[model samples]
Target: MKKARLWSLLEDGRVQCLVCERRCLIRPGAKGACGNYVNVGGELFHLGYGRLSALESRPIELKPLFHYWPNSTALTFSSYDCNFHCPWCQNYHLSFRMPDISQPVFSPEKLVELAVREGDEGLSASFNEPAVNFDFLVDVAEHASKRGLYFMLVTNGYFTEKALDALLRAGIDGWSISIKGCKGMQKPLGNIDFYVPFRNAKTIKERGGYVEIVYLVVTNTNDYEDCYRWIIEKHVTLLGVDTPLHINRYFPAYAWRKPPTPISKLLEIAEEAKKSGLRYVYIGNLHNPRYETTYCPKCGRPVIVRNNYRVVDWKLEKRDNEWKCKYCGYPVPIKGEYIPEKKWLGLM
Candidate 1:
């Protein structure tokens, strides 16, 4: 166990955890909303640190971030417990549980070295809400950067600005934040504003870090057409027109199992988002080669061709230290620090 960096001592032996939006005022000898942070004798402890529930190499495409370093592998890992209890959580087994004895403990440097041994040039905090063990991610990301590996986060975009500031200071190269539009939905995170994620995404882009967004379209939940338009408008006006936003289809899983999002709806939302002057809108989760490929937003020429998860071909040219489409010289917003040489599916 380690002391959390984002906590404060309160009166009468209560420690306030300011990591995610929950901001739990944990009482002494009790865990917070995530069930991982504990107020031990008037001080908060991050019990989830180094206690990994899942670890593996994940495709950047699987993160649905086609614009930022396509086909790059994120040597990713996550810890137990989460800040939010989303009923449709896909990784509830890890996120909604405590650290078991069967789980192995790994230091920050060890994880970076593990990625190096596997020839993976990217490291990510994912599979669970990374806000819980953010300091650990910072240590690993800072160490990984020294070894020429980029760092990123696949997060639920429910963290506070204080945590975001720490992550950027600790060498986070990019982020893939999933934004939920329905603020008043069942069990919505407390004290979180709907516009906070858009604010955070804009800040990341302005600070020279890559930001890709995902909106998981769930049936009869947060899958409204206006949600897509709002996200598109924010992406186009605030982030950039070329900002990559993925409209992902949500499957029935975890607690809220209604039905999978229709593929036609994803296609329709993608089209509407694109028609709103936003480039690089993609339909995710449901497989279709036609929707997976990246085309030049200005010229409409295929720049990166993807089949399922593998990159079939790339038509980007690096000239004067910028990646641009060869067809129209339109700059593609892809920020490729390092591309994985081996197939991640084939064990890179």
Candidate 2:
């Protein structure tokens, strides 16, 4: 544990955690709303700092970031703790309940070294709220940036302005913000404002970082037609219609045991999203072979085809720093090139 950042002390013996939008005022020897911050003798201590809970290599597509670095691998790592307590959380074992197994501390330099050694083009913090490990993320990202590796985050996107600024200032290259439509949902302790995720995504983009939005359509909860339409409109107005939007399927997990999302529902929305003018739309967390592929918005040709997270086909060419479809003159919004198929065959 380290001395936490983005927090301040109180005169009456309480400390406020500014790590998230909740602004949780933690009392002595008590944890914050996120269950990660603690007040230890009038000082705010981050219980999750530098505690490496999981680490692995994955394609950027798995982050659901289809536009930036399509097939490149990123060395992703995350510690314990989250800003939200979603009952439908898939990684409850990692995010909700901190693992009882031993979690070792990894220094910023050590993490950067590992990423360089592993031959990753970038690094990502995922599996939980990356902001909970703010100090570590900033330091490690700064070091990694100097070593020619970029940084990305898969976050719930409910950060305070200070937290968001710290990340953008540290050179976060890309983001995937998950929007859970649980606005005004009651927790045992505090309530949540669901719109904060959109605000966080906007902040990242306004600060000039590439961003994509993911919405898990849960049946009988946030899967209404109007809700999807409103989000699509907002994405067009705020983030741009061309922004990559991932419509992921929800499955039963944790406390909420609803039926798995229907593939028919995914297709229905995919058609709606296309008609809604979203250039890059993907259906994730479930296999819908048709929707998983990226096509040219103008010519209607399949530009990138994938099986699972693996890219099986890429038909893009870079000219004068812009991506163009090889078949037609249509421009692709993707940022990086598809590495040789062989280079992407293995993480090494």
Candidate 3:
């Protein structure tokens, strides 16, 4: 029940929600496209503030963030409501449906306390669209950053420039923006424009924040080689060769009943990305053990070997708080405190 933080009033009695690219204009007593922000009597109010739907300590790899923290765990949280209505959404039950907001409210301080108690490396706003619950995320992130805990946003990267800037200012350590597909699909959710990754990646990189791109390759929708190449050329050429890319295998979920993306297609896309001179490309959702590991681009050696979401072995050496492969002295892109001596649970 917080007043929406990032919106403006229009002259025609409509309020514009500057949360995402939608910039939804809502009249009095009407909700935005996200379903979380409402124009209540000429004022904008956020509906999902302090309302959490799920919380857990999960492996960092489960966020599929291999380049950020290879083998650590993060305290993850998700609230109800999302800005985009992606038909293939896997978390529709929670994101699309309104939760019982009166169940219980956890303040930002309490959420930070829980994250610290769990001994997690960071906090991940995932499962649902964190942007829809922007107020809660900013509050929690501010507290977590003050306590030296990292903050991550597993978002669709469709946030408005102002909202995105505010999150970066609040000390967001990492961002994994899902690039759904190239432009011009049947629905709003399926389209991914060249401007999004190209623009957002530059912004994230300039802020000294880690940015990774996740591409969910549906069979006939966005499985084209040209789209993949465009992403590589745009991001890699503009950002850097070391920028991380996660090619996720899309399964039939929610309203999408298509077959799962084939392993061969995933491999081919990875190969295409590699040939485009991108260094770190990964395949997700499939059980190909070798594809899950991170290899040193310099010497072609497995620097961080993974078994699903678990780190089987780490052959990196730390020097001045940065990780580099001892074999060839090549810098590793991962960012986290390395606990080589601590034993950890294997991936489930």
Candidate 4:
């Protein structure tokens, strides 16, 4: 366990955690709302700092980050628990529990070294909300930046402005932020402000970090047309139309087990997003290859072809510092170097 950051002491012998938007006021010997940080003698202590629950090498595509670095590998890691209490969380096994502090610790330097040793191009904190490990992430990102490797986070975007500023200063390269819908959905998710995610995404983009948004369509929950319109409008207005939007299909998991999201509904929303002038829209968690592939916005030609996370064909050419279509010469908004070869390294 390590000393936590972004926290302040309270007058009534309590401490407030400022890492995420929750602003949990933890009393002595008690845990925060996320169950990862504990108050020890009126001081805040991070129980999950440098302690990992899951670690493995995964494709950036698995992060659902198609535009940033296609077919590249990232050393992804996650700690236990989450600030949000989504009943239908697919990663319930990881998010529903607290960090096992009894287990061995993995230092930030060691994690960056392992990524370099394994020939990964970047590092990602995923599978669960990463805000609980904010201090550790900043350390790892600092080390990664020094070593010429990129660092990213797959988050629910519940972080406070202070935490987001620290991450930006640490050279965070990319983000795959999840948007669960607007204000009415906060009660089931620990009363978190729905606008926090969108706000942080805009801040990151304004600071020049790559970002992509993920909207998981749950059946009978946030699958309404108005909800989709809200997300699409926010994505365009805040981030811009060139930002890639991933509409994912949700399956029943954990407590709320209603039914799986229908494919027709997922497809319908994706189509609507495209008709609304989103340049890059993709469908995830479904086996339809056509939706997984990336197409040239102008020429309607496939620039990056993929079959279930593996890039099979790359038809774009780099010209004058931009990835352009071979047939139409339309510049695609692809960042970083395109890795031609890849190895499907399974979970460790």
Model 1 lDDT per residue over 107-221, tens place: 9999999989976768888888887777688788789878988888888777778988888878897789888764444443334565777788888888888899888888876
Order the candidates by TM-score, highest first.
Answer: 4, 3, 1, 2
Backbone clash tally for model 4?
Answer: 0
The model with the greatest TM-score is: 4
Misplaced by over 4 Å in model 4 are none
Q: Residues 1-348, candidate 3, lDDT per residue (tens digit)? A: 789888889998899999888889999988887788889888999877788888988877777788786666778898887877677899999878874657687798998989899777789999998888888888888999999988898888888788889888888878888887664554445433546755776888888888888889887777877766666677677778798888999999888888899889888989988987888888888867688877899999998887757777888888767788989988888766654433345322
Candidate 2 residue-wise lDDT, 132-177, digit = tens: 7888898988998899888999988888889888888888869998
TM-score of 1: 0.94
For every model shown, what is its TM-score relative to the native structure? 0.94, 0.93, 0.94, 0.97
RMSD of each: 2.0, 2.4, 2.0, 1.3
- Candidates 2 and 4 compared: the better one by lDDT is 4
- Winner by TM-score between candidate 3 and candidate 1: 3
Better of 3 and 4 by lDDT: 4
* Residue 55 error, candidate 1, Å: 1.6
**Predicted structure 1: lDDT:** 0.79
Worst 10 residues of 1 by lDDT: 182-191
Alpha carbon lDDT of residue 284, candidate 3?
Answer: 88
Candidate 1 residue 283 C-alpha distance from true site, Å:
0.5
| Residue 152 local lDDT, model 2 | 92
